[model samples]
Target: MSVASEILTALRSEEHDPVRLLRSASNLLGDEIAVMSSFGAESALLLAFVAEAAPDMRVLFLETGKHFPETLAYRSELARFLGLTNVQDIKPYLAQVKDRDPTGELWAFDPDACCQLRKVEPLDAATLSFPVLVTGRKRGQASTRAALPVVEEKPDGQVRLNPLASWSADEITDEMKRRGLPPHPLVSKGYPSIGCAPCTRPVGENQDARSGRWAGLSKTECGIHTAS
Candidate 1:
């Protein structure tokens, strides 16, 4: 079957749960797996799961350089705990940043341009070699992603599989606790949703986990999630 046919068929398959679906996809792709991780609040669960299923999977981290220090540190700690060997750090294009905006205040001025520079461009370089990428997105987390499928396609000629698409906040917490996984430092400090330092804020008492990200703004994703 063609790649498109295989993806469509897999999307309709009910035999594969989240875990089994990811494992099957890895096997189908000949073991070239790219696990894009943000090392955020609930990312630990995905890291742990992938560590167990595919320990050597290429864990891609888009190091936007503007990320919180805590996030970077937690990322390292989590990788060590999970025994992940291939943690690839995808960075921005130096020449573009230097030529376009040398002061690096692009994020403060134009967020869209900043995202294109850091998140979009980096992932474009990172996942080019992989046929499939596993994301830790959950449907219940956001309104836009409420209908996310277990498996979907990206416009970049590859598949974007949301293994935990059906998961909820409670489920994620339970799994993390059950596995004895430590939450990110900012997670318990009112910042249920942690992003880059400048943009991220503490969530309100009744706000969702992702409310802290791009707080007070209509933007939900950092362009990386919406990449086609």
Candidate 2:
């Protein structure tokens, strides 16, 4: 079996344990693995696991120029709190940004294109050398992800690991509470899902956690996760 398949097989038994999965992946992939984070709601849970298992693991955060000031601040605060030493902010190319979105209002007319420019391109470029990618996506977050797998192999042979794929919202909340993890400040304000400022909003108590993201539009993801 290939290394990816072996990794998957080994992780099957401990799929529910994020820290164990992270440690195993770190051991297997070493410098070829990196974690992609948004530093949004519930992000602390995954970062905590990274801190415990691989404190120096490369953590890539898409620093879209449109993120809320609160999110930028929270990213710094959470990194400090978890003692994550390798968190890097991935930003889009300045030439592309100026050529495509000079006014910074592309999100108003075409959010998908904006996301492609700011998130997808930057992440694709940043992760080109990494063979394994880790994310905190969960099945319970949205209907589109209801069947998310713990391990997925992209067409290009890159392995995407979702250690928290099977975790429920309650499980996440309980674990975070038990660990005293600090939440994204916007979560208490009803923004259970936080993204770029212009395309995100607060949802009702009964709404899906991700419903506030790209509200009124069909776009659910920021293209970084969906592309490739």
Candidate 3:
């Protein structure tokens, strides 16, 4: 079997233990792993795990330059609060942005292409050296993510390690509160799932956590998680 399959099979036994799962991956991958975080509502929980298991593990954040001022500030605050020393901001190439999104109106016309220019390409470059990537995505976040697994290899050969894959929204919130983790300021205003400012909005209490993201559009993911 491949390395990805072996890790998945090994992680199956520790599915319920997020911390241990994180540690196991860290032990196995060592410096070859990094975490991708949006620093959204429930991000603190996963960040806490990173701080515990491997404080120096690189955390990649897509600095799409379209985020709300609050999100940018919260990103810095949360990283400092968690003592995450290596939170790196991945930004798109200026020439690419200028050529593809001159007026920055690509999001209005084609969000998929916009995401590819901004998020996907930058992340692909940022994570090229790392064989494994850790994410905070959970199964309960959205319909598209309902079948998410703790460990899975993407078609691009990147192994995504979702330690919180089985965690529910409530469980995430509860744990964050218990740990006294600071929340993303927008969460209180109903923005449960925060992303780029243009694409994210506030949702109702009954809506799925990710409903606010790319609201009213058929688009669910930003094309980062999907294979290229």
Candidate 4:
């Protein structure tokens, strides 16, 4: 089998263990692999894993400009900690933002539009430079992602790799501790899941892990990684 085929085969064979799956995928791709991280909750652990597993791998951190200050700081610190040499700070068009909302308040009245311009557009632009993108998504995180596959084809035919597709919340937390990694600063403050500041909130007691995102809305998946 071709090397790519082998990587896909091995990734598909597992459904619940993110660390082993990701480590295998990283070895198969090596310098060709790139991980997409927000440096949010659970992200530090994944990054640390990558650093040790494949120190030469590149990391893509999309800077939506509207991210929480903590997220931005964490991204920088993680890169320094990991000694990632080829980290890329992908970002949206600043000219477009200034043209539409000079004050950058677009996220207030029109969050979806803001996300498209700041998060989605920037990420799409960055994705074209790589053939594979690894993510930290897991099936148990929400209703929409319950059927997540370890290997899938993006609508654009770009290879979508989800190494953590089957991990449970407890398992992830345990792994983080096992690896001696720290959680995102906002995690303990009730932000079980996070995104743009305007849409994310503290999760309630009975809420699922993703409830903090777009709290009142029925929305779940961020458009950047969606197949549709």
Candidate 5:
């Protein structure tokens, strides 16, 4: 097996132990490992594990200028609250944005292209030197992610560590409470799944957590997770 595939197989052995999964990444990749956090609802749960596993692990936050004020504030608040010192905000290049989305309306016509411009491109650039990316995605969040594995081998060979892939929403909520972690400000307002402000909305309690992310559109993922 390739290095990525071997790592994925090894990580699959402990899908239920997020801390161990994170520690494995820390032990194996050290500084080459980084995490991608949305700082949305349920974020505090995974972040708590990251804190326990590797307090200094680099956490990448896509500062996709379109985020809600609350999300941005939550990003800062949660990172401080968790004692995570390596959180970095990745932003799109000014020239690219000026040329492709100068009017800031790319999300109105083609969210996929907009995501590529604002999120995917920036993350690709930021993570160039890193080989593994830890994520907070869980299977219960949405249908698209229902089959997400604990570790994934991307098309480009970077491994994605999803320590919470098997965790339920209730499990996350309970863990947050158990750890005394604060919820994202928007969660109380009903945004169970939060993303960029323009694309995210509040969903009914019965709906999938991610139903609010791209409401009327068929788009589910923002492109970063699935992109090569």
Candidate 6:
């Protein structure tokens, strides 16, 4: 079996406990595991676990220039609230952004390419040294992630860990409440899945949490998660 498969098998019993899963992964990978966080709605839950289990673990945030001001504020507030010491803001290369999206309107004409330049490439560069990448993705957020597993090896041989893969929306809310964690400021404004301001919108009551992201387009993911 691959190392990721072996670790997944060993961690099966703790899959339901995100804190335990994170702690175990930290123990197993030492300094090779890092987390990717969007600091959007429900991000605090995973970040809280990170604070408790691995306070100093590198928490990478894709600081795309187009994010809502509220999201930027909340990112600072939550990191302070959670006592996270290593939250790194990963920004896209300025030269590439200038060359590919000179007008900064790429999100209007080609969101996929926008995300590739702003999020995917930056994240890929930020995580190059980490063999194990942890994320806050959950199955309840979108149909595309419905079958997400707790651990899987990517095509590049990197182990991607979705510690909260099976958590429901209610479970996330309850746990965050139980821990007294604050919600992202945009959540009250109807953004269940917040992203860059230009591409995100407010979804209706019955819509998927992630339906707000890239609203009219068929694009569900922002390329970072889908890319190897």
What lDDT tens digits, residue by residue, belong to model 2 across residues 37-145?
9999989999999999999999999999999999999999999999999999999999999999999999999998999999998889999888889998999999999
TM-score for each predicted model, relative to the true structure: 0.91, 0.96, 0.94, 0.88, 0.94, 0.95
Candidate 1 lDDT over residue span 1-228, tens digit each: 125676557644832476666566666665555889888888999888787777777888888888889999999999998898889888898998897669988877777788888888879777777777888998888788988887776666677778788888898899899999989998888877677787888877877778877777788888887876
lDDT of 3 by residue, 1-228 (tens): 135567767766776788888888888778888999988888899999999888888899899989899889989999899899999999999999999999998998899999999999999888888878899998898989889988877776777889999888888889899999998899899998998888888999799888998899989999888764
lDDT: which is higher, 1 or 3?
3
Give candidate 3 regions above 4 Å deviation: 1-8
Cα lDDT tens digits for candidate 4, 1-228 = 123566667877753455566677766666656888888887876677677767667788888777899888878877887777678888888788788768888877776777788888888777765667888787888888899887776655566677767777888899888877767889889887878787789988878889888777766756787733
Ranking by lDDT: 2, 6, 5, 3, 1, 4
What TM-score quantifies how close candidate 4 is to the native fold?
0.88
Of 1 and 2, which scores higher on lDDT?
A: 2
Among the numbered candidates, top TM-score falls to: 2
lDDT of 4 at 211: 86
Q: On a 0 to 100 scale, what is the lDDT of residue 82 in model 2?
A: 95
Candidate 2 C-alpha error for residue 72, in Å: 0.7
Clashing pairs in 6: none
Q: For model 4, give the 10-residue run with minimal summed lDDT.
A: 1-10
The residue pairs found clashing in candidate 2 are none
Among residues 3 or more apart in sequence or in different chains, the pairs in candidate 5 whose N, CA or C atoms overlap within 3 Å are: none
The per-model lDDT (C-alpha) reads 0.79, 0.90, 0.87, 0.76, 0.88, 0.89
Query: Which stretches of candidate 5 lie above 4 Å from their native place?
Result: 1-10
Q: Across residues 120-153, which tens digit of lDDT does each residue of candidate 5 receive?
A: 9999899888878899998898888888988787
Q: Please name the candidate that would achieve the greatest lDDT relative to the true structure.
A: 2
